[model samples]
Target: MPPIALFIALLLLATPLAQGETDSSRSQPVVSVDFENGVLSPDWKSEGSGNATLVPEGFGAKSLLVTLPDQGSRFVHIPLSAESVRGRRIALSAHVRGENVTRPREPWNGVKVMLKTVAPGGTDYQGLMDLYGTFNWKSCGLITTIPADVTEATLMLGIQDASGKAWFDDVSLLVLGKLRSRPASPPALLPPEKLDRRTDLPRLRGVMYGPQGREEDIRKLAEWGANLIRWQFYWYDGTFPEKRLDLALYDQWLEATMAEVDRMLPLCEQLGIRVLIDLHTPPGATESRQSAIFQKAEYQKKFLEVWEKLARHYKDKPAIWGYDLLNEPAEGSVAPGLLDWHSLADLTAHRVREIDPHRAIIVEPGPYGGWGNLPFFEPIAVPGIVYSIHMYDPLAFTHQGVLDGYPVGVEYPGMIRGVLWNKEKLREILAPVREFQKDYNVPIFVGEFSAIRWAPGDSAACYLRDCIEIFEEYGWDWAYHAFREWHGWNVEVGSVKDDTSPAPVPTTREKELRAGLSKNQSARAVNP
Candidate 1:
């Protein structure tokens, strides 16, 4: 190890973890660059079919610039030995500039400054920031937690799958202490199966929501003909950025969330709306990635502990129809055979079943990259379980104006990238999920799906209409991505990105949704 790396390793070893410790707020500079010398140093190397050079950039200074000539990505990275950053929490940030960048097929493929760690076995982990189109110098950063077992670490900056010019300067990585200490595993609970007595699932339709004094949303949903509500019950406190996953705060918020649930149950009961207790954020689930819970056995235990507590507490709550095991399970660099998302979800569902067998257990497959997750995931063999998927397919079209650099004018039923996306396309996207239901003879639920409220040319409504039409055809329980949650997903809002407020009048997005949901006008959850 180099002198600085050796010092960091020694300092990390000398530091002791306090009780209930987490990632620290304190950070130290690890490496940085301004490229003022007008040369791309030997420490940095370029990859892919793109031009990379240190150029006179900004005012009298220099920045590393990458020009992608065609449709591909190129990166300039500083490779380092694992000792330099392994097991440490780090932030990678750079002043980045992009010009006339076209949209890429994937969300992560754009103007990028990311930290990537690779285990020798070939498992890769990254915290990425993607930008596109014309943008001046913007400071963007990503925080990543490195595993102790990593063999190589890299800080990468570039433009990907886009034809444009991007410049990077003032790039730096901050060592934010070390990874969280392994908490003691909670005792394991026995997996249970008594599905023969499971309550029959209703043909439900609703939307996912993160409720905050939005009890009135229930009435609005019922009027819209919704019989279900997937409450994104975030148990971890989010009031403080640094304390998002703090253990004490997690427990405190968990209790507070249950209290809120208690207050809403009577209203749901009266409205005949069943609540799906969706644990949106579990312990160790961070803003950077959803894979943290799968990294450590202790973290998985903490996750299961949350479910076990809820299972025992709400086992008798008739207003709650089920427990949505997790929000999105994107396991990163999962150690082979030790733990994968499928096994963990199966284990969690069965554990929840042990306490509340009557209400069905719902689980979503981890998005394992490439051809997406749903089509590849096999049905979990746990009895009394319903398979789920959250659809925002062809994100370039659906999420057009919501996130930065997302290209606009891509409408539904039109060619996107290279393929036509209509109702049949939606069917093709969900084909694997359909096969899962058919092959297993099991129920399916659309835990969440939606386009941005401001998608172009009534695209949001058109896409939603087609999705709902197909979902109903297949008898899948469906829920829009949100209801009174984020203004971006609020269908009632008009198609104006800047106007995040609720629509003064019913908009096209709401019209289509209400048309689909109107089927449930008299629908009621048979809360067993």
Candidate 2:
């Protein structure tokens, strides 16, 4: 056979082999370029193919390299198998490192690589492929989806600038499943044994003087279903000692008050009652002085010292539910509003716990019982601490006839009329209490709420009835202002008598009102 004829036959045979190589390059699954090694593997090609060089930093090594213009981009394309990414959420991942780069003011401007997908029918989809921002070497990823109708795709990585060299390696495309959602937490369970315990246990019922006044009438209050009692203990009054700040006077007052308290303790204990012991100071005492007492550290020190003594004295007593840290602390009277009452209360409660862990502590909100402006229950976080709110709303109904110019004159507004007095309204009034329970799981006590004397014809009684009904419905325990007549007691029909003497006149109006309302269990024991 001739030589020319043989060569021509061989060339024809190699044509199919060369076509197979072209198809194999398009079927490769991963496309990666390492500028350090200057390589494009497995028959893959680059744009500007002639100018781009494969440089070797070391022997037997190759890396695909492109010298990029300072302001323009360099592009690379690798055709992928049509079957490799059909109907999938394709995630492209790569390791990137930047070298000889100008650090931009914003890190994000450092370098960006983007992946462009060309679909089977000549449509293009572009997504952020990966980013390299002043990183020594970092693993970065991008994600894109293959169109449902497209069977083939081409992936292109385009570099933004030639000033910064970026090397990408081990690039991959994968299909991922949907992410899982986090599970929800279960609801809390109530303690079974104490489930029936009243959430609203303390409601203000009545106010009574210290042991000096109307002891007999005060004793009768429990029978009227008064669950709470507020009794004051004064330092300068006869109960302690007049014009004496000595330790002996303090001890004498503590002893005398405790003896009296001991006598009343059994009465309240038997009646399932709670008592709040209020430490009282006259309108102008060293401790009561506006600026000095609460503002100065020494005053607060003395304040806590007094409470420490009291807490130690009644440490184990349960009938005494709490101690009223102060009474009607006026604006500018105590430490400024910002002065940490919660912390002060917490310190007192801490001392109380050291002596009596069981008895709850009640601290009034600052600025003379501003119930609506009460701070959140930070102090009451201690267990057995009850938040107390004193309500004398629309004070006209409470102090309608007072000569001293109290905020509310002694005109009882006859029950807070209409649905505003109903259960939902009651709930709204106690919304903070509910929130307190939800937040810190604590109980609330309305320590003092009452109408003064001379609130006209059965108005006080009607208000009392509404308050009692609402409180009872919510299972709250409460106390009335006063069980008997004092100078401030609001029994319009009752006559005042000395502390030791019987009433000069029988309370005929009280008797008539009580008889009319005594049908229910709560009202039945009125005269008992």
- The candidate scoring highest on lDDT is 1
Per-residue alpha-carbon lDDT of candidate 2 for residues 298-341, written as tens digits (9 for 90 to 100): 55666678788788877677777677777655323122332444
Error of 2 at 479 (Å): 1.7
lDDT of model 2 at position 311: 86
- Per-candidate TM-score against the hidden true structure: 0.66, 0.50
Identify the runs in model 2 with alpha carbons over 4 angstroms from their true place.
Answer: 1-209, 213-215, 235-252, 266-273, 282-292, 331-339, 375-379, 403-434, 490-528
Best by TM-score: 1
Every candidate's lDDT: 0.69, 0.48
For candidate 2, the lDDT comes to 0.48
lDDT of predicted model 1? 0.69
